[model samples]
Target: MVTIALDPTPYHSTHSLLEFPDVAARAGYDALQLTPHPDFGPFFRYPKADDALVRNLKKRAADAGVRIPAILPVQRLAWPDETRRRAAVRNFRRIIELAVQLEVPVINTEFSGRPDELQEDSEAAFYTTMEELLPIIEREGIRVNIDPHPDDFVEDGLDAWRVIRALNSDSIGFVYVASHTFHYGDRATSLIPELGARLGAVYAADTFDHNRSHGLRYITNPPGNAVRVHQHLRIGDGDVDWGELFGTLAASGYFERDDALVVSNVFGEDETADETSRFQLDRIRQLVDEARSAD
Candidate 1:
């Protein structure tokens, strides 16, 4: 019943997002969750001219009744060195600037574990990165939501909390992926309650497959594989626990009408994409309506 923002990358890649943003608006979502892609050529790319185009595009979205609340930058943070780390931080600042202009509140990032950073004092490195990055987040008046994915250094809800606790920064938080928790931990259901407040956004996906995870790319450019832990699909098609999941979101004070759901289960049958996504959205709309009417 919390609000829904559809992650459009699953439905459309980098080049295809401009075209699909309107589709997302028409699909009854108020906001869009942007993804980062790496190899999206030099020009004519989606996020390439995003800075210059954001205002007008936001206006367009306004006309379409969709507002962008967050953009997920998952890849660059996973880079193996300080150089890439700093550059990614700068890029994240840019994303926050766009969010400010678009009136979005958060930019989702990864608590990346790159091969090198992990070998060293990961906890210290993570906080150090945040210490340097916090100024940008605060300057932009935005929170950077960093979640622990299985592929990343910080896995499971508890470790995610440990890192968040270690950093102890107001600007940095966690993105809860139920599938990630389920696949990578002892008891995902147990972790959800403890992680509720830390949960910045709910990344609802079906499977717990860590191999082809889809939400990891921070560039939003094309060609680079999105290190997705799960291939997002319609509600009933995957292994998520809907009853408890919905209950958790409903109870979480952070849940907002502006929250998003990035649909990516458009892989199977062409008909499946349309039919399944539509049905899922409809059901979600009903849930939202029911929640509102209850109030």
Candidate 2:
């Protein structure tokens, strides 16, 4: 099983995402979640970024003493429009470039329902990205893990499976987010293994609210809404069924002798954003020790 870490992007620039490695180390997490261009801004597709930015990211990850396992861009790349789709591909490539520098393990992007290309052609786009990036990812020795978020075109395991199977490449796979899976109305326990070899990693969190708006608020700002619906929450606090979650992943072949990758976070009416994450990590450390024994 793979060890889990937290996605610190919710805290944004104020916190150096790489700085969380100490917290993860303290919490006993193994990796960190990163994104390309953070991909959601109107400026996500900047053609003018220098390679220094990428180099800085690599240096930052090294300084943190943790590795970047996945790149979860905030943008929705699964689109049906040709132009926007091409732009998305370019954006994808740029992030992958940085992942190579950081020696990151996966390039994690989400598939929103709105397509910039033909829906039928999404497979083509998926392949297009793979075809273009695989050589570089392989050169960098990184894998690309695309997550199926509720806001995207492929919002669940079935769609994620279809898209991943279409690519038929080892460099690409799925990053499972539990709250997102539950939002798709299917429990993750049932989804992880059906993915088979295409399963790359799992993105786990706890939450109460269940709206995309609430999720986005969490993404833009920590502890997003007064009514938080699951972008990031500490395990066991909200509505998650942890027992079922662990059982499913174990049965899914993700955990055998018991290695797990969980990026835990909780947003609330908190003061310091970093403290919010530290608190969440502290909580998860206690919960995981309670839930599973570390051999």
Candidate 3:
């Protein structure tokens, strides 16, 4: 079955790391994707989780009837700078250890490279870092899904997938985030099919097509400044074609996969997160059902 998980970022401020499973359960989720958190894996830094903390977190999730299918740790793995790239590799090894300890199979992350400066170098650095970490990942039997985040060196979805494919490791896959549809070249129909089983997970959120209205959805200062603008709006609040996206997933047999994961990561409306999360769960289920029926 497609595991619907909550990102739980909205509750980070109010809830402790150990309390996340209960929050996810209260929000109508049976699983939660652990993102970069200070208590566990902070962004671009060494992880803070000890063996005791990991054990307690696992127990908490079990008690709350929640499973953590994935963990997202944003590291500068593709940084053009050697020092940062080395640090990222070091941090990622520990992250893989944490994943092994927690029994989580997937680690979703970004390319984390500087595209604006020395794009080629960033790509090269990414490959170098992967050379160092892929062995550990494969040995541990963990899957790493890369998201071509906006502003990353490989923002285009296909280009990112090519980078992952060139690595030639099934341990690496792609994360299709709905909020980043435009940045991904708005090619879900083709991209999802192209990735096929390599599509590790899908992040559920809505975003406006910045390319619309002559790229005026958001205005930046200094006119031609380098910026990537997007949002993590609730479903139906943005321009993402829910019908087309879900339809493509269904037709591609994603719904039949046992490892399929869809995460609700609406970070815009924390004030109403509980209600929004519940709504997302119901709406996502509806979309999945509708897509399957149509398929």
Error of 2 at 99 (Å): 1.3
Of candidate 2, the 10-residue stretch with the lowest lDDT total is 35-44
Which portions of model 1 show Cα errors greater than 4 Å? 13-15, 37-47, 78-80, 115-122, 184-188, 208-229, 252-272, 285-295
Candidate 2: tens digits of C-alpha lDDT, residues 1-295: 4455666555555544445556455544556775433322223363333567556656665665666666566433555555766686676676666556556666666664343335566655556656665687777767767776654555657767777777766777777776665665665655665776567776556665454355443453445333314445556666677666666665665554342456654444235555556665666555555445531
Error (Å) of candidate 2 at residue 194 is: 1.3
Q: For residues 162-259, what per-residue lDDT tens digits would candidate 3 score against the true structure?
A: 99999998999999999999999999999999998899999999999999989888898988889999999999999999999999999999999999
TM-score per prediction, in order, is 0.76, 0.74, 0.99
- On TM-score, the leading prediction is 3
Q: Candidate 1 lDDT, tens digit per residue, 1-295? A: 3556666654544345455467776666666666654421111122453655666666677777776667766545545566766665666556566677768787776767643345445555566667767887777778777777656666667867776766666677677765564545635456656765556676655653443357332234475543434545566666566666655555544445344333332333344444555665676665545544443
TM-score of 1: 0.76
What TM-score does candidate 3 get on C-alpha atoms? Answer: 0.99
Every candidate's lDDT: 0.58, 0.58, 0.95
lDDT for model 3 comes to 0.95
Please give the distance, in angstroms, between residue 265's alpha carbon in candidate 3 and its true position after superposition. Answer: 0.4
